[model samples]
Target: MTFLAISGSARRASTTTALLRALQSAATPAHTITVFDRVGELPIFSPDRELPSPPDSVAELANAIADADGLIVASPEYIRAIPGGLKNAIDWLLSCDALIDTPIVLAHASHRGDDMLGQLRLVLGTVSTRFNEAMFLRVPLMKKTPEEIARLLSKDASQTELLDFLTRFAAYCGSAD
Candidate 1:
């Protein structure tokens, strides 16, 4: 089974990225997990300019999503909402009719008053994507240290919960599930 773990945060090594890593640890080595952290490469969603042809990077990203058996997306709240970069990627993916109704497992890293998951759901829902389990990281003292945040994101129960969720999806190529 192939699972594409998308880090909604474009940063190199963020809490959101770490969360994705921990999720991968629960999966068998054969599971094909690709992380898309290059939101910066996706151009803005301009219907007119993108009509005749999509940008090269946008096309590639869409193709990848369509081929994946399932998707694990971790979106961090920015400015009390979903970041524009992730929204842009979603917009491009929606243009691909073949990828609609794909199973999406959503995760979020939120501290303060942030409801980015709601917006992400709205975006994916509009495109007819089927949502799976939703995970949230909202520990009280994660601000104190990385170890604390890592522990919360990599908790044993959480990993098992995620693994069980992914197992229910369609056969992932070579996936032990």
Candidate 2:
């Protein structure tokens, strides 16, 4: 199975991005994880702007979503909300002729307990995207030391809670079909 990660944090090595990569690495060997890093380039939703020809970036994103079996969204809380760029990516997806039936897992990271995760869940719920079991944790991973973070990203990540969540999600995807 191919799992796609839609990242809202565009930074090359943001905390949320690093955690997501860790989760993907922790998943069962039967699954393949693909991170979609083009969210920042997708044009904002505008029928007129894209009528003649949709942006190549948008099409590339759509194709990635189309090809995935399941999706994981890891967003950062900006002003206690999901960023407009991520929202626009989802909005542009709604205009596409194809439907994204892949099961979605919503996740977010914040210094405080922010609403980014809840907001993402609402957006996905409203769009008819299947909200499979999701995992949400704060930045720095709560009491984990730098050494622990490094260990979690390595081959032993499966023993961590984040990996446990992905293992559950992977099972859900297999049975949901």
Judged by lDDT, which candidate is best? 2
CA lDDT, every model vs. true structure? 0.67, 0.70
lDDT of 1 by residue, 46-124 (tens): 8875777788898888778878877777777788787888888877777756347677766555455356767777776
Tell me model 2's lDDT, rounded to 2 decimals. 0.70
lDDT of 1: 0.67
Q: Candidate 2 — which residues are off by over 4 angstroms?
A: 97-100, 111-113, 133-148, 155-159
Model 2 C-alpha lDDT per residue in residues 1-177, reported as the tens digit of each score: 888888887876566666777767666787788877667887678988667767888888778878887778877777888888888888888777433566777655445535766777787777744775444434354335546666655644334766676676777777754
Best by TM-score: 2
